[model samples]
Target: METMIGLPFTPKVLIVDDKPYDVKILEMKLREVGCQVAIATDGLSAIEETRKFKPHLVLLDIRLPDIDGYEVCKRLKNDADLKEIPVLFISAYGDVTDKVRGFESGAVDYISKPYEFEEIFARVKTHLMLRSLQIQLEEQNKRLEMLVEEKTKELVEVNKKLAMLDATKNELLQLVANDLRTPLTGLFSVLDSLIYEELKDQLTKDQLKAYDKAKQQMLSTLEDALLLTQIDVSNTDRVYGEIPIQQVIKQALNNVRPIATSKSVSIVECEAKDFKIFGDQNLLTRAFTALFEIAIRFSARHERIQLQLGTFDHHIELSVYVIGYTIPPDYIGTFFDLSSSARLNILGGELGIKPAIVHRIIALNGGSISVKNEGPAGVLFIIKFPFI
Candidate 1:
């Protein structure tokens, strides 16, 4: 079967020879294999057409009228535009010196003539096939390089836009949340007063108890929202000082004590007695606050939540474990991802406790956190900080 393998445009060949019959024969042979041939009867015409035609390959005759093939090959090689094109020398002088000269003059191959008709056909076909493959390879490589460059540029542009959008979003959320804090705090105070004043003598004991519990939960939600907003605007890199492990864990435990009491859950604090680490007090307090809230909300009724702290190798580690309450296995790895906040809300869960934001804050202070679903009961959140 004949192959229809040529450029969609045309596979051009420039044949340089002074003989009319030789040029015609070569032209006819090349056209049989799907190539467009251009004839140049002199060296000067060859050079001129090389510039204009920009042929994919060149066939040259050594004994030209003006410049010999050796000089023509040298001149073609020296031209930057034509240097990459393959040149095959067609010569009648089959001497070894002529062959050597052809190679040294930059011709890729030398063909001796009076050449056999089939040999000429075969040699030209081989060289032209090679040239076509080479051209295709070069074009493919160029396209691949272009694709890689375009993808890299797109990634850089996307990252730049994301950084800008992140900054704007943080600022906007901070403003809105901050503006609501004062009023929310006042509302809590007003609720407290109303509960005592309006229902002092009119309510059954169970009704009063339920109202108080609901009121406390509302205040807890309000605090979480305010802290989350503040975190958005705060610079996470600023570490305050050494907060003794005992004090940090104790404070976190105290904040969640009321909720734990309501749920009848026990908290076992097992911090290393003397361990201390440098960190931002408010930030660490908030981190534990979120963790403690998670324990209180997720632990089974009458279950135990244990807080353990220890120091090892210039790092402080804290482990919060809730007994008998399991986090879903799939969520263990990315439970702290900021985007998981939406998932949590969708499941009718907490509003402001974003694991992603918490992870970022801890990371900024040279610390890390991980949650694992394994062991005795439920999930274990492990936090480690570099002892500064």
Candidate 2:
């Protein structure tokens, strides 16, 4: 007898036969090849031992004293738990009709007796190998199902944490805007009352100009804070439609003309064909106004700022060229970041949050904005929007 190697486990076999001499010989042959054997002398005892041993394969003899082997196979096939165990019939009847009956009763294979021991061992090895492969496949499927379930649970937890963080950020922005705007409104009313003809005559020319400048700065700060809060909290409620790019630029230039005139800065515009894009018209005007204000604030007296417009492929591009001041190298990367007040300090005023707000508005409308230093000329701001 040869020992089997590389099987998944030791095969368990049950021998069902009344002949003691044949059973003894077959049991010895199976044990030599690393099989665990259980013996049953009749059909009734075969069924009982099969349940207790839970064997991988069964070898049955048809001519038992009690119930026949064909009937025993039928009973095992009817059972939900035992139906998958492979059964082979070893009997004295070798006719074709007898073989058919054994297969119809759920026997996997048939062998006629007065049989050679070598042939019996060969058939037994084949069925045991097949049973081992079936068990291995079932275990692999169970492990794969468990892995998929674990990953799905992890994704659900991550999405829940992200939703909570977004809500907290919105609440904080609203609180800051409300707290600062209340005091600034009261101070603005006091300044307006001082502009009467009687009160104005008592002040010198320089004194009245300083008071006007202070009032303007306070009003601009209040407007920026309120708009920032609205963008963060209710930006989803916007009316989208087709907008003319030339019209949007005209509106922005008109809004910032007073500030540019006060600084003695000249805005030079290039004539180009009008282009159209899909977005909220009011929001685009606000974003462009902020960009022009920043350019005017950084320019020297009598310096020229240029606005150029062109089209490339399916996108419309707008470039704002400020000709006097270039951004410092260290602050270029974080120029549009929310916490970039240190960079704005170099410009002698605070304009950090305005850039962040412009970036958000552009992204919400499916556009993009970027700034780069243009060396001796100044800094260039480029904005692109899809026209289709």
Each candidate structure's TM-score, on Cα atoms with residue i matched to residue i, is 0.60, 0.63
Which tens-of-lDDT digit does each residue in 252-357 have in candidate 1? 7788798889889999989458877677877887777777877677688898987777876677888888876666667666677755644364225543454655
User: Which regions of candidate 1 are displaced past 4 Å?
Assistant: 1-10, 16-48, 61-80, 91-108, 129-176, 203-213, 226-285, 296-318, 324-378, 383-388
**Which residue pairs collide in model 1, if any?**
325-378, 338-356
TM-score between candidate 1 and the true structure: 0.60
Best candidate, lDDT: 2
Give the per-residue lDDT of model 2 (tens digit) for 1-388. 6665668788899999999999999999889888899999999999999999999999999999999999999999998889999999999999999999999999999999888878888888888888888888878888888877887788788877876676667677677767767777786677667664558888888988877766666667667766776776775778899898889888999999998998899998757566888898988899889888888876778898899999877789999988877777787787877777544564755464677778877888889999988868588999999986
List runs of model 2 lying over 4 Å from the truth.
1-151, 191-219
In order, what is each prediction's RMSD in angstroms? 6.8, 7.8
Q: What is the C-alpha lDDT of each candidate?
A: 0.77, 0.85
Error of 1 at 329 (Å): 7.4
